[model samples]
Target: MQPVQAPVLGPQVDYRSLVVVLLSPLAFALVFASWTIFAVLGVELKRVLLFGEVQFAVLLAMPMLTGALAALPMALLARRVGGRRVMIGSLLLICPLLWAIAYSDVYLEFLLAGAGLGLGAGSLAAGLVYVASLCPRRHAGLALGLYGAGMLGAGLTYFLLPLVSQAYGWPMAPKLFLLPVLLVALLLWIFAEDAPRMPHAPLDSLAEPDGARSESPSWYWLPPPAVCRLALYYSFFYGAFVALALWLPGYLAAQYALPLKQAALWALAFTLPVGIGQIVGGALADRRDFRDLRWWVSACVMVCLFLLSYPDFTMQIHGVHGDIALRFSMPLGGFTALLAVMGMAMGIGKGSLMCLLYRDHGDDMARSGGLALALGGLFAAVLPLMFVLGNEWIGIRTAGFMFLYAALAVCMLLMLWDGARTRSSPLTRHSSQPPSQAD
Candidate 1:
């Protein structure tokens, strides 16, 4: 028999060699901002269109829901048409959708426009795949971090869009926004290079069976166990993070009775910590193993759960009907510390998860990334419904939800530890070694 050989890794890529890497990040940034347009614009849209809270929330979440479902399909589309073509098509599609949203006079029209929002955000799955394919294995972590910076683009919409809305009004905001997205797409067309496809396990070929194929019968295209682990982790990570992003503003306003402006400021504080954490987390993941990461993330979740459970102790923002006698002396400091911890954990966990997937999946990053994203989005849908139902039926609040979810996280972590241990055991035979061939 011919000797088995490891597939060759892509050549080491310099910063200059990977221009499309920048496009993925840029694409992600735009999608992040667009995905959040509802949160920023929902109130205005409600007033302009005379819609209810339920209606508004649906509109706000429709893009996210659709984007979640669209990721796999988008990945498939990218495979069929090419990432560059799909990305540009998605971006151009968004311009008309923005105009439709801007000019929409009815709820149905706005909802239709919301579908367009999903289309734009769906591009992220494809972009993640594209960027991962371009980077050398060693640099995937850094590339994910840079791609994560696109998440900060939401902050831009929150801060700048409001200012722009004040000056130009709500309808005009989307119209003006189109110019920048179009410009970025134009830049990407000129500067972004195509990703180089690498040889994969023949089992991994997404293409339908043609008459002939690669000759390597020994090769397999299965996703690495590490990638599956990352996907599982992301279901909890993004679910919790994005749920908080969607839920916190409402929680602050209703539970704490803060003025809208103050609540918005508080929400900003909450989000800012996550972005900071992302940077710190990405750096740590580059160095730390998943074993250490488990402890760190668990600890962060526990602390945040504690803080969230005790609003009176943590913030005292809620009005106390019975007694003003109770006080947590260092409430603000303690709350800030916990939030920072949670943010750092999320940041690190998010980047590490992507990095691990890339290490395992390598050139098949799109399929793996799409799976990760879809699972996370799936959790995002389920978790919120559970939260709402728990609130309605059992009178559980956000803190209660946090405590419950955090417990689930602990259990999942244990499961992962056990799984990892089993996978690392010597009992599993290597491809080259027979069961009776142990040395």
Candidate 2:
């Protein structure tokens, strides 16, 4: 790779770039909030429709599945047309869909309209490209983190839906988003630029001969292997985050028998920390290599997962004196605390991993970011079903935690192997330098 260089800046550049960074993630947060609308709404939909558990689960997963599939293509479109345009287009696309969802009473109609929320995945990809291009190397992690913290938008739905539905009814809940979505889309159009030459290959690579660069369209869109490695790390953390965000309201409701609105409120414990921790992780990533921090974050999450994986059980012992019985169950307070810690750890993992992505793979930001988001979406989609099946097949409520623990173990082992391989490499040595010194 060509040596990193400092970007030339004008007085106006900083102000403009600042606008892009601030404005873009606001757009992202709104998109993200809208993306998971079904999470809160599904509870009511179930009662009204009288749908089975599996059908409810499918309805929950459909947007994530479609979003995962759409992320890459939308990212590719962003690459050609521009991040600003795609993000604006994505925001606009969501408005009609929200209307469709609010008006629909049928299960099939609501399900399909809900699927349109996947456009937010595209919003994420394109917005990341626009924001990362303007961030200086010294503050890339912090910039990315701030952008990521927009995920707090999910909380808007969590906190808002209960009040909206309670007052106006469930159908009016989705309609509430229509004005804000349009407002954000309009702001993006007025303030955000296309970032004409965002992240792409080095100047040297751009100078390659036409003959040398010739390749199939399929080959051209593929991200490099190094990027895929980073995506693997991100997918697990982000996927779990998304899955739990969707699953938790329901999980809390069923496991504790809490009312749906109350359960949604409680789940803010997990979702809020995840957003805050991303800012923490991204700032740290900007200052140093993330490998060591990644290990610590993973270890913390694993410990929590280990605790969470245990199901309620009773034990009996036969003794000469008498019979002894022991019983154990997870307390709601303790479970919420564990969820908060794990969410923070996962958020840190996500923040740092994304920083690392921009650090190394910004040159192909669209494809690489798309690939990671897509994988995360697929993982999120699979997890709800797994939660359902695990409960049925294994007859353990904590089975979802068990599955996550296993997946995280595999990720950690792979990271360790990769770390050992890179330890002695020149690139690793160079990357260890401080951003200012390295540049």
Q: What is the C-alpha RMSD of each candidate to the true structure, in Å?
A: 5.8, 3.3
Clashing pairs in 1: 278-347, 281-348
Q: Residue 161's C-alpha lDDT in candidate 2?
A: 91
The CA lDDT at 83 in model 1 is 70
lDDT value for model 2: 0.83
lDDT of each: 0.64, 0.83
Show the lowest summed lDDT stretch of 10 residues, model 1: 214-223
Name the top lDDT candidate.
2
Tell me model 1's lDDT, rounded to 2 decimals: 0.64
| Tens-digit per-residue lDDT, 1-439, candidate 1 | 3344332255577663477767677777777677667666765666677876557656766776777888766865565456776777778778888888788788998888876788775567777766666666556677776776567666666666666677888887677668878987897778775555444432345453565554442333234576666676766776666656655555555566664344445666656766666655655555654545755675667667766665444333445674344564334446446655676677667777666666556556656787787777666655545555545555655544564456556756765786678668765435336633321
Question: Tens-digit lDDT track for model 2 on 1-439?
Answer: 4456433221234766787778878887887787767888888888888877788888888889998999888877777788888888888888889889888988899778868888667888888777776777678888888888888887888899988998989989888888987888888788766675633443223333555664556676677788888898899998999888888888899899998889998999998999999999999987887867888999999999999999889999998899999999999999999999999998899999998888777667777888998999999999989998887777887899999999999999998888888877887777666565553
